[model samples]
Target chain A: MSADVLSAYPASQLAIREVGLRDGLQMTARWPSTPKKLEWVDREAAAGVRYFEVGSFLPADKVPRFADVREVIAGVSRHPGAHGIALALNQRGATDALATGVQEITLVISASEAHNAANVRRTQEQSLAEIANVVRLRDEAGSATIINAGIAMAFGCSLSGAVPEDAVLRMIDRCLEAGVDMVGVADTVGYAGPRQVASLCRRIADRLGPLPYVLHLHDTRGTGIANAAAALDAGCRILDASLAGLGGCPFAPGATGNVVIEDLVFLAETMGFSTGIDLGKLVALRDIPAGEMPGEALFGALAKAGPPRAMSWQAARP
Target chain B: MSADVLSAYPASQLAIREVGLRDGLQMTARWPSTPKKLEWVDREAAAGVRYFEVGSFLPADKVPRFADVREVIAGVSRHPGAHGIALALNQRGATDALATGVQEITLVISASEAHNAANVRRTQEQSLAEIANVVRLRDEAGSATIINAGIAMAFGCSLSGAVPEDAVLRMIDRCLEAGVDMVGVADTVGYAGPRQVASLCRRIADRLGPLPYVLHLHDTRGTGIANAAAALDAGCRILDASLAGLGGCPFAPGATGNVVIEDLVFLAETMGFSTGIDLGKLVALRDIPAGEMPGEALFGALAKAGPPRAMSWQAARP
Candidate 1:
């Protein structure tokens, strides 16, 4: 009598990408030192986390927390198994990111015009042009780095209310046309429900065929985990989550962090998906940030309530 | 273009049952007075919440908080459209609940043998016998009260660990045989994920075709809302949730409250289900419990992050 009931989808194919070091630290009042950041990456890498969004390539003056982006990327590169991803909002950031030889660089463009303008002070067309320019710069440099484009507020925008599906799909098409290697659909404001997530992901899958896309979600309104599960049901394999659910959208007021990775791993494993990450080790990493960023709110249920007594990974695995 | 994405299933068929007064207050340090409880019921009823688990019909000396169960039920009955439900652990409680003319009375039998023994000091067999006896008593009295038997730890258990699906199915069969009008499957310790919830619910639906069942979930590990969404996806209509996610299991150590009714209603409405609950009024109800239970912890995301600005009930409704 196995306690686990397996998912209908392929479990081994599920992938949990760590965005805490970058996204989690972005909104913090204080950030860990470069060494501490590297240790965070190394510990998580040792715990079987293979993908990490290490930091952003924005100007050090504008976002001082990510000033050590190059150093962090260098540290992550040392781990042969781990792939380092950095966010690059414009061509300058993308160029700087490519210079560091980062494994992956993600560019973001909002589906809602209002959110896009508020977030990056640029229109959707301008952001699309920046994405196209970044692609050209990457090709010219002949970098093997993966170029990923994330459509922020893809579900619905806080600033601009309802973001039409056509607008999001069109942006994805333009990003694909711009030669990005992959695309990510983000519920930047945590405004999506499971049904909307599944519906959009299904449409993306139908449109892309085999092209990979990531589901970047925020748990601001508590639908994050549910939306992640819905995405998995709709054939999404790649997901972006923060450790302890740290991070928030500056433009999306009252927004919380990305979905908690520790809980997400628990969810994926229990749902019969093999995240290949050890839950105990991943949960332990919370202490590092807690010690460094004191007074900052840390969120996760697995941290408070240990895994179910009957939770057996071997039984859950396919 | 409507921002709302409708669920494939019937939206109007969904029902969100409030269990805050009964289950939420069960583990609280202090509970509101009978008048306050009635006021809570009235306000929620005004917000279109028709189903409420008012209180448990246990001995006042043992559980003093529910001493005014009769008063609460009577007050709830005053609302023309509202249906009041009370929990009855044994024959005495069931009889008392029936005598009050309550609309519904629920009997609980844990699928986990150890949980049954620990919680009620009775074996599974003994609980089943009690259920049968209560059914006989109701018939003799010519009561029209709906008898719902909940299979506690239906997903998994803290005391006994894994609760076998076969064991739960067997319990449901016995309860139905014992003349229960409806059934509920409870994740007593929050030891469930969406996949497991959907799996068990699908099995139960298959075995008891068209028989209405309720999903009683706990947000113990942050998977409650996700599990609720999965239940809806699996054709479950009625769901049990607590206001501000108050409540915990004394037997299941470290368990949190039931799924937040405000968040669940938000989830239901946003997922295109017409719960008929006014999200604004429902959310405002959080203040009542917060003000009454001063230092007690209350939980919900929608309460903190106001509804998505574009959340239009007209658009969400099918």
Candidate 2:
């Protein structure tokens, strides 16, 4: 078979970014100690996972789970070729994140005005301005760190209802103008279906030719993995998912975690797109969170069912 | 907007078959009483669900839960325009099912030889021969009932693994030659990914133009809903799903239920297809099963998260 016939999306371009330590632990009942967190990063990196959202830079008093963000990033940096990403809501958080010399710092701006005001106590314009300041700080420091501005509630919002497509595009235009290295569209509350995800991803590609963007999805309504496949169909190569399907949005009622990374890898690999991560090793990593959290329900089907026996179908591709 | 712009697939062409009564109750920890089963049928029918797999015609000793299959069908038959379907594994089950005057009767034959042998204790050829015998019996009875031969493990088999596309097509061809009114391809073990679904649906369409086919998918590995979307994209309009995702296969280890009907309806309605089923009413019906079968886990996301505030996007389209 020809290379194109082997897979719709080229394997080299596809990437799965693990956000378990950061997004997965954000709303957990218990937190893994710094050592356990480092162990997760190390083991996943050894399993061929190249990108990880280690933690977020936020107030220690508010989200004490991520209080050891600096230590986590330092440990992640020790592994060569493993990129660590952290989240920042404001310039202060962004400055602190920069001080850690993290590989990537994500700044979020909700597309919905109500969500923007409620989440960060600022208007959409205000959030955009903060992102600009964060970009300036990175440039002035002569750092080569990548800045990714995520448009939260880009698909729809729990507070504001349906987010218009043009509003999300406008936010992306502003983020691009702010000199961010990349932009991401997030279904913060899992409001997006596959059609909506495909429509939005196609529009993003159309609006900004070859500029890179990521899809950060939540599985609150069971559409996350489908949306991920739609993104791949629309030529999106980077996706954000959590281990054991951890994480939820406080603002979005009944919200669940991001799409499970293990299942996401399975979906990608089985679809003939190589994710570089070993499915067996990555699925085994679920035990870490299950052991640490104890009572917390870690969700994923691949972990429960194990990999299909015929997983080598992709390997036999000529 | 033109009607074509409203939905990629015309709303009238889409159909969701409720398999909860037969598929859902099969493996439940507790089975609802006959009256409760009738209530489920009545409520979902009132909610505008037209097609239902009421129960299977099996030996009462083997599956006592379905011993009242006759009563359930009698109850469902009273609802005008509500079509009841029943399953038959052999000629005797088919004879009993035809006697009930059910609107549709489904006969299953696994594509994988091992799965067919293990599931029905017959070879694939033996099962196909029985299907032909059932069709002869239906014709001789001069019944208007539709015979649907479901190719179980059509995508892949847990017992044998990786059922090839040609194998499924061969089974489908034989079924057509046997004079079945309709055919279905099932992902019995949840091994199918979206790409495989799209490819297979396309081939089925190409091989037999305009032949109606249903996709009976399980959410064993979290790809059920995604596979449903791919089927729709590939022009297969019929889908089989259960309420609260309440079915599993003994042969497929760790198997969950069929894709939740509530989520499937949510996905269809949000994608601009008019299912003619009330989302709220259908979600509310989940309570009946929960109350009747206490401690049996009912799975679905739309029931937990509720519909999005801006669900009228489809209605507003041109």
Candidate 3:
């Protein structure tokens, strides 16, 4: 029997970054207190989450939930082996994020022109130009920050309904042309199934040969892990998740924002892949932010269920 | 590029019956009203759920949640092709279910001795003895009530921890010996991942021959859909889903009771297999029973994100 495409996704050591504290909380009705959000990052880092997208630099009024994002980034950045990341919707956001001394800056763009307009009130062409400006700004500042051009709504868009592959390809072409250090793909609304994700990611991976791309998922439709599996099969290096399936796009009606970081980590680890995150601390991390946020809905598998008994179970495997 | 084992699954008429209403809701909070319970079955059946296990015939005091189970079964039995199933925990419950004229009777047993003792305070032999008696009772009653030797916590038991394959096989042997028409497997504590689920189901399927085994999932550790996919790959037909990822086991800490029916339906349909369900209507099922059970949680995907576009942008040759 053939080993198959999915059976060969680098046998774990798969790295998943919790982008929820930044991306998820920013879009919620309630925001966690600065310290609470920091505690979330701290607990996750303690749980073995090596990568973090701490915050984005949009106007505080535009996303008040992320007002203290800067502080959250600074506090979490200090932890050893725990990398801090920030989002850049445009040149200004990129410059501000780079100024934080964070080593990684993720620039997001949309594949659909209609969605790009609806998302940031800019056209896809304008978003592409912003990517160029952000890259130049990071380069001029002498920050060798790993610039990942994240193509948001790459699978399907709520406003536009369905996004085309050529549209995603064009966005990838623009990101490559802008000299991005890396690229990322997202089913921002959780519309991707396993096969659909695999097929589209293979097309994207084929185009952007060898560059590490991030796979961001939303459990809104509960295909988050399935999509992640497909992405892994397509060779995506980094995955984005939240602590407890936090975050949703208010404009997207029913969209859940991103995959729960802890759950995805368990899936990778127990499936014979190694994610360096500590499961015990990750489960505990749910409490720190939940207490402060109050009404914020936190969703995750491992947070509610403790870590997988891989050690004991593997030992018992006859 | 050869076809994977997923091809063997019945793609056209995949009727997933949610036994959670009977099996899952039974163990939850104080029993809801008869109308409230019927509302769930009505909504789910209307949402393209062809089969629904509305309630069980266990003693009222022991499992008050299913007290008015007779009303629920009678109401849902009216829906065309909606096979109203009821769980019979013992011969007495089975006799009561037979009186209701339910087409399907699910006779459940815990695969592990520890779990069996904990669940019904009985030994495995005692449970099997009851199953054989119920099968005889069904035959004498002159009803075509098929028995499903539903094994709960088949993957891993909370008390026993890791349920052995031999234990599962022993139960299957008992089920067949007792003349069960079909067999089913449950991951009651949310412990089974797809790889493990696939490996186990293949062995179980080998013993059961062509009798379809349903994969009952709990999203406790976030491997529900992946396990469903694995089961599909292993040629299992029926799947169990709750309306909206509602109801987790209180005893199982992190277990999200069952896979969301809408999400499972969405996953199967979008993967190019026909599940004979209309995705759009499935989301509307939640509305009918909303006020009846105010605090009850429901989980689903298509309810969040709409269906995928028939057209994709991958630029593949038509």
Candidate 4:
């Protein structure tokens, strides 16, 4: 009997977009100090992760969690060379981002019609209009802030059960029409299984062709890391992660736990992927305790279980 | 780039064991109702999961959290054709298990010297002796309880840093010497990443010659589900999981979260394995609210994020 030999995925590389400072803290009640976040940026950069979604320029009242957007951006930008990213929900946020001197900007839109309305109090069409306006504003500013139109709720919406591929496709088209530099797909509610993640990501990548893509995944369903792994196999490079897996959807029922950055980094590194991360240092980072974070529970396996033999995925290879 | 092709993993005909009633509650401060545990068993069975680690059989005073083991066993066994697995730490536990008339009997041994000492307060040799006695007891009882000697801490140990693969292989020899039916591997402290899990499992499976090998995983470090999936790819069939991602290492620092049974089932299904599960029913089972049991944070995605359209993985193939 011929042994059914399965090929290991190609040696891949991933850029972790640390979103804890933005999306993660935004969903929580107790936010961290901007200095602490900036400190993490310095340290994470040292650990070798690039692309960081450092903060979001949303109305401070809407999310006091990100009250230090300007401070964070200013602090991270000082790092000689670091890809500090900020989230801009509208033209105003984009304009605010243009001043902070960040290298990248992410504009988000909800794909689920119901989630778009309930979450941002706007329709998908309106969110698209805002994205289009943000794209134009970014170009006019002549700043190098690469805008990646991040589509939230692309797989399944918290409010709606079915997220149509056609609907998600339309949003991608809108982002491209809006002249955005790149695009991102998110399983915002952590509703997507791997099959859905692969099919949709493959479809989006097929449409966009080559240009790098980002995946913002939630582990609310406990499939975050697995889905992220699947996304990598589907040709996604940039991964949006929260330190200690600190992320969730306020609207998505039971949506908690972003793909754990430390754990995902370990998975990639061990699998012979050049994640440019030090697994040992990443594990130590998750060791820090964040208290009274409420429903925002910290999630991951490699941290608690300890590394399988103080084994750095790199040490075993090189 | 040969248009990187996306190969879908068939809806995994995966078998999940919800250990919340057993593994999760056993190590924690609280254990919910016989009714609640039974309710979960019935709900999970209807959800298409065929096996469950009903509960442990330690003295009630020693593990009052699992005093209802008999009831759980009786309640779950009534489900016509379901696999009810029970954990037996000693001869007494095994006696109770034999009396309960379970389909399987699983014993534990930590591959790490320090871990084995801490867990059952015995040396590796002592544990083996106990395991051998339990195996003999099962034989005498004329019970069909398949003996599974799970060697935990196979990858690495929290206290013992690096658990050598040879040590794990030796434990398999001990289990085999005991006349046990099958032997399984576990990342007791969640120290395993995908590569470590795959490598260790492959090496162990190579030595064991396939005795219905199982993987008992914890998501403490966050790679539990991925590790389990990797084990499956490495040729392990029997896997251990807990409903709602419950369970943790009482001794290990900051290690909690099991491989969520529902999420694993979802991964298997979406990846194209026939787990013989009903996703819709599984999602609906969330209303049972396993989280109300106190201090245990239960998790599963399909229960929260509605299944993706293409998530009817089984149906998609035909």
Instruction: Give the winner by TM-score.
Output: 2
DockQ of each: 0.38, 0.44, 0.39, 0.32
- What would the per-residue lDDT of candidate 2 be over residues A194-283, giving only the tens digit for each residue? 888898899998986766678999888888888898899998888999888888666554456789898898888768887778888888
Write candidate 1's Cα lDDT for A107-179 as tens digits.
9888878888988999888888888888889888977778888889888877767777777899899888877
Model 4's alpha-carbon lDDT is 0.72
lDDT of 3 by residue, A72-165 (tens): 7788768876777788777777778888877677777887677778878998778778887877887788875677788988877766767767
The estimated TM-scores of all candidates read 0.93, 0.94, 0.87, 0.77
What is candidate 4's lDDT per residue for B1-318, written digit by digit as tens?
011001111123345667777777766656666787788888888877777887788888977777888888888778877777788888988988888887777899998778889888999999999988987887777766778888887776766676667777788887888877777788776766666777777887777552456788887766777777677767776778876677777656446667777778877765567788877777666555545465455555556655554453234211
lDDT of each: 0.83, 0.83, 0.72, 0.72
Question: Which pairs clash inside model 1?
Answer: none
Better of 1 and 3 by DockQ: 3
Off by over 4 Å in 2: A1-11, A252-254, A313-318, B1-11, B313-318
Q: What is the TM-score of chain A in candidate 3?
A: 0.89
Q: Which residue pairs clash in candidate 3?
A: A12-A273, A12-A274, A13-A274, A47-A278, A48-A277, A48-A278, A165-B313, B244-B298, B244-B299, B245-B299
In angstroms, the error of model 1 at A81 is 1.0
The 10-residue segment of model 2 chain B with minimum total lDDT is B1-10
| lDDT of candidate 4 over A1-318, digit per residue (tens) | 111111101124457778887777775657666666767777777777666777778788977767788888777777665667788877888899888767777877788777778777888788778877776776777666677788887877656666778778888888878777777888876777666776777887888676667788988767788777667767777788888878666656445567888878876765657777776776665533253354456666666666554554124211
Ranking by DockQ: 2, 3, 1, 4
Best-to-worst TM-score order: 2, 1, 3, 4
**Poorest stretch of ten by lDDT in candidate 3 chain A:** A1-10
